[model samples]
Target: MMTRAFRTAAVVGAGTIGLSWTALFAAHGLTVRVSDPRPDLDEAVTEALTRYAPHLAARGLDVTGLADRVRIAADVTEAVRDADVVQENGPERAEFKRELFATLTREAPAHALLLSSSSAIPSTAFTAQLPDEAAARVLIGHPFNPPHLLPLVEVVPGARTGEDAVRAAVDFYTSLDRTPVVERVEIPGFVGNRLQNALSREAVSLVQQGVVTPEDLDRIVTDSLGLRWATVGPFLGAHLGGGPGGYRHLVEHIGASMQSLTDGPAPDADAQERLIGAVEKAYGSAPYAELSETRDRRQLAVLDALSETTGTTTPKEEN
Candidate 1:
């Protein structure tokens, strides 16, 4: 089994995701070094932790009096100097990441696992800059926003990445009480992002064609598909589709329909205009602040309840 917690982790950037990453590490008793050139980086980190700490406490997390472990550094080299792992949350552009990783190779600790929080770009595009660098130790560790609440972290390894590095990452995230799904192949958008985009495209297209308003479309998914997805993934759901026979019946029948699916074109100008109009009509001009607040509370409540019944610590103790 991997260690319980990463000893030290450097978070290189203090954007929204970067700050949340910092909070997660600090709350978990990991020494976290946060690096960012932004003048307000420290302020941003403070604000993010302040906003999220309460929610974490409510979930039975161990953030009590542990916030001070977060250290703000002026640059990447200083941040990663003694760290066991480094999580880069820098600009999404490939060129920017290339330069960052190259600099990291020269400064970061020899065995520190370097990971990117990128949703789309793969490590292959950036690790090239560190030719002699341990490319195998560099991989993607994309987390859902508000990393504390949502536990899914997609782990994608580059072609040259070693198995040890990949497994280490999975172990590291799991230690943080997060779910880590590893992708053997480095496909574009990985899995979650692609699945989200596929659904989003259809949702947008529906609204653009006046088939349904945005609110109604969102409702349809949330009331139906999202509820199911929250419990089980699409493939597993399909596995249960044919009852005892599993997906065998699905493949024998609907398999042909799947093959006939097309790579449709992007939404056009008219479609966008219609979509915008539909949004206004369905949701009205009222601000969604109240709605968002309500949704957040409800989601967190459900998560807390689920955690109680299907949590890590209690089940292990019982077993």
Candidate 2:
């Protein structure tokens, strides 16, 4: 029943996240005005759009004439003028964001939906200075890295945000074929990052303890947990792991062992060096740009296979 259309989107920031968002908006047929202080904004954005076009096409999105729809703006005010949705991907500094949001609240049209691409900073951190009415339209639309490919957009609303605005944000993302998961309660790092850090922490600990080399650790993940999690999440995997007995059976049998594992020591400074060295040796030799392109291509292929088998597209694909 939620029906909303975003015809023009303003992407504030010309960094990686912002550029990816610009490409995504253009692919979805929205007129995108990108603003950033960088002198090379036009060249950078154009290149990013070009890089992302094939990926978007592979995901079944229409990327025809995508570059023509994007325009580069000199400042935030110019970018957001007449924008239906303002996706801010500014610097993570709280003070800077507070000032930036205040400007957005003042200059942006009242009907405009102000969404931030902040990862850890909550909406309240910046919206605190805005008027109640303006604050109500602001919320977080945090996406994983490479927003053009990743479909998970965490829609976290501040305490003062309106329910209608949240619903509209969800509908807007859904229209773009994104899976927007609403965070009912605001928490640091939202949900995805928190879960990611939890696993990363353990991974680092294991390597620090000399239990596994970084390459071996990564291979284990890509082969086992990553493959399984790509299909079913941990909870569901646990449910299946219990056979016919279900989650209750899992807890009764392995809960104590799991608790013990959780008590493992955190990684220390030495572990950091070992992890860095191992990772550097494993993949640091290749140029990051090449590795990133390879990663995106492989991700697309995996998603294609997943879609064929599951009768549902991966988060990266249009639903």
Candidate 3:
């Protein structure tokens, strides 16, 4: 059984992320109040729940009339009045977020968690207009494309964000069966999007340069790097690649060669210099043999799951 740290949730905005969040919240047994200025907010919510209901059921959540748990608030103020957490999925414009948060901080209960679905905008940027007290409770809760399926939720806090609020955010997401990775620093695009942007840049370059067609490029990544990354992260993957010697050996032998492989005219010297240190700082303490075994186990588990999905039956055709 899972513990629900929160009961009432106010989803501000009813767009893609907002709609998915609404469904996920309700599926997790949280009373959801959704606020959006859209005239078709009800239809949107219905369609989203209808689409996500099956997926939620596969994940062991009850989908029978799950829409009954949701309420469409007249406005943000009414929506957040009794909310235990307020998730803002308003426009990405910084000014819009700045203004939206002003109202959220004022209208939502003092104890209510304030989260934003901003992909690139940092919490500090929008929360700047807020006073210290309100800003302390505000943070970024950025999710991957579809919140209902993906488990990751980047919990990014501003300079003034309180430790309690950060901890609460993690607990809140965990309660919803979401994986909340609390970022140690606040940066635009946070970590996920930054890594995505970096990979995308090269991907576009490769396609444009006629190195590989888009279709084949995607197949290559999805079959190779994507599959590998699904188990251990890039950092851990590199650490494991070193076999018995670990990351230090990989750096000593092929670090320069790997850096040369990038398309950059000049590699970021500072990052290049810090590469070994940072990688070591994160993974050096782990016992090499045990870590390798763990990576292998994770890799096999992912492969086993893939075989079930891809071998016995073909994957669902993407629309």
Global lDDT scores for all candidate models: 0.79, 0.86, 0.90
TM-score of 1: 0.79
> Which candidate's lDDT is highest?
3
- The residue ranges of model 1 lying beyond 4 angstroms of the native Cα positions read 1-5, 251-319
How are the candidates ranked when ordered by TM-score, highest leading? 3, 2, 1
**lDDT agreement of model 3 with the native:** 0.90
Clashes within 3 Å, all models in order? 0, 0, 0
lDDT of 3 by residue, 45-153 (tens): 9999999999999999987878999999999999999999999999999999999999999999898999999999999998887889999999999999799999999
Q: How far off is residue 297 in model 3, in Å?
A: 4.2
What CA RMSD would candidate 2 show? Answer: 12.0
Q: How displaced is residue 63 in candidate 1, in Å?
A: 1.5
126-156 in candidate 2: lDDT tens per residue? 7887889999999999999998888999999
Ranking by lDDT: 3, 2, 1
Error of 1 at 128 (Å): 1.2
TM-score of structure candidate 2: 0.82
lDDT string for model 1 (103-125, tens) is: 88779877889899998999998
Which stretches of candidate 2 lie above 4 Å from their native place?
A: 264-319
